[model samples]
Target: MTADNALPDCVALRIGLAARALPDTTPAELVRVLIAVLGQPLTEAKLNTLKVKDLKTGANGALSEIDDMAALRQALQCLHGEDDTAAQAAVPTPQPDAEGRLPNSIQVACASNSGERLDGHFGSCARFLIYQVSATEARLVAVRPAPATTRLSIDHSAERVKLIDDCDLLCVLSIGGPAAARVVNSGIHPFKRSQPEDVALLLGDLQTMLAGKPPPWLAKRLGRATGERPPQPSEVAS
Candidate 1:
């Protein structure tokens, strides 16, 4: 298989593991796993362009031809099975905020195309909606347009990362492996959602997580923000 048709061993392993561990894994979740593993943007168009045989070879002899999204979903389902009830039950219940405030508020950058929803992928978003979030509330801080040139040049991914360097978290429809790594390396957290969602709803969820005992990842984010100095824009390349 050509390099482009090859799936990295790490990605294949992850897909296999996720299929087994989360037997009820949904297509959206599978896509998230794929994007996270590849560390690059993945679109339906890109996926459809890949041949089934090529994908099978790349998957280390694990997968067959997935000609379309439906086929891809079926392939993922065949790897395991789905249980919607269990999946829904797995979600944590929201808890009330102790003091309606966090030790420190965090800034999040949401990738957006229309400015109304979190509908854009990290690499292609028209702008980022910045929000300052606390345990009880989230407030809009800024709407920063994406750098025009960065999208045209892959090498400028770092420049794109710089645009949201000040944010504690980045929420997007999707993000590639390399860009996600760059974001993490810069001390920012990355989150992927399945589809376009209301920005307000996402903020509410953040608030809920803060109000409750956050997961280890989120707790670490909160802790990190307490001691770290806010990154300066000048520190990033123009």
Candidate 2:
């Protein structure tokens, strides 16, 4: 079923407000935060795809009837709280590192000027924005979306792709192979892993490339393959 029929109108409005307010934020980022904060239901009972028929029930009245008008008050309440938290988590100022590099995980690219762009990939939306750079490389980061105060206007998929297509870097924690392939094929790299250790390793590799220094380990691998230097660390920054 379409979201219009699945989701109530008030939910749509809340989502719209948040989407419109993100200026440079993407729907993926919002969904990331939303999922992080809201979480999913943990019922062990799995619903079957096939519909069940009540063959034994009396014909006078169906065993169950649709009550589409039932209030979605509870879902709306959850959305409202989550939206607030997500909004506060999205402030875009870069924090400092000892070497003055804006941690590699958050870094977009090295600019001639003192500025850089950061990409935040949340569920269904890919948010990209340039922030005043305080160092050579700023770490790309992702924050969860806030709970909704009102409603959602649309589903997350289309909105996310729109933002990703227009974004510079594709930073995300978890995405399927198909989606990952899309981002890579589009000439955007995906940060599939987002742990601190992974981010540090990624940053170190990128920094080495940026400085034109190839690590022996990487050089060996690349030599065996194409006799060319591996993708520069700056590639990740980009």
Instruction: Please report, in order, the local distance difference test score of every candidate based on alpha carbons.
Output: 0.58, 0.34
| Model 1 clashing-pair count | 7
* Deviation from native of the Cα of residue 30 in model 2, angstroms: 14
RMSD of every prediction:
12.6, 13.6
In terms of lDDT, the best-performing candidate is 1
> For residues 15-37, what per-residue lDDT tens digits would candidate 1 score against the true structure?
33323222223223444434433
In candidate 1, position 40 carries an lDDT of: 59
Q: Provide backbone clash counts, one per model.
A: 7, 39
Query: Where does candidate 1 stray beyond 4 Å?
Result: 1-103, 149-154, 228-238
Model 1, C-alpha of 24: deviation from truth (Å)? 23
- TM-score of each model, paired residue for residue: 0.53, 0.37
